[model samples]
Target: MGIRLPFMVLHAKQILKSTSQNVHNRNKYNVPKGHVAVYVGELQKKRFVVPISYLNHPSFLDLLNHTQEEFGFNHSMGALTILCKEDAFITLTSQLSAS
Candidate 1:
């Protein structure tokens, strides 16, 4: 069975995808074709290029929810900025990739 995502989740995903594409098209960032760039950290943010497929994962969606609460969709960064510790974000993505 397929998982159903909330409207907010889908909205966030679309925004992120659009922003990523724009950045790539402008030749401002070097994100690969099927990946997106996300800035993760609390104080000093670090950038991570992850597969766009991660957006479909429940855990990643939860992170997106937190990001929305903290930074909202219109962050000035012009990219998806996830308000989280870099290590924790890395661990979650690592686990997701491993599975």
Candidate 2:
């Protein structure tokens, strides 16, 4: 019983470590403190990090609504993507920054 307890403890530790490491790796991009990375552009796609606050903005919500309709929340890129012109995205983010 004593030997089994130690083995189980070691196995649980390994599982916890692996789980945390995977989470760290998965969140390495497209997510940061108070920001979200969104893939933008029509042809040549580019990534942009915007404040999470922008998510509350109507303009940003419009983009998200469009993304939902176009991609249906399951993007092949495995990340949230905004299907729009890069310039339009820039313009929207800039507006949020000004406020």
Which numbered prediction scores highest in lDDT against the true structure?
A: 1
Question: What TM-score, computed on C-alpha atoms, does each candidate reach?
Answer: 0.76, 0.66
Any idea what lDDT model 2 has? 0.62
RMSD of each: 3.6, 14.1
lDDT of each: 0.76, 0.62
Error of 1 at 8 (Å): 4.5
C-alpha lDDT (0 to 100) for residue 20 of candidate 2:
42
User: After best superposition, candidate 2 residue 77: deviation in angstroms?
Assistant: 1.2
Mark the 10 consecutive residues where model 2 has the least summed lDDT: 4-13
- Where is the poorest 10-residue window by lDDT in model 1? 1-10
lDDT (tens digit, per residue) of candidate 1 on 1-99:
133346545775676667755745448667777787888888887889999898878898888777776667676666678888898999999999999
Q: How close is candidate 2 to the true structure, as a TM-score?
A: 0.66
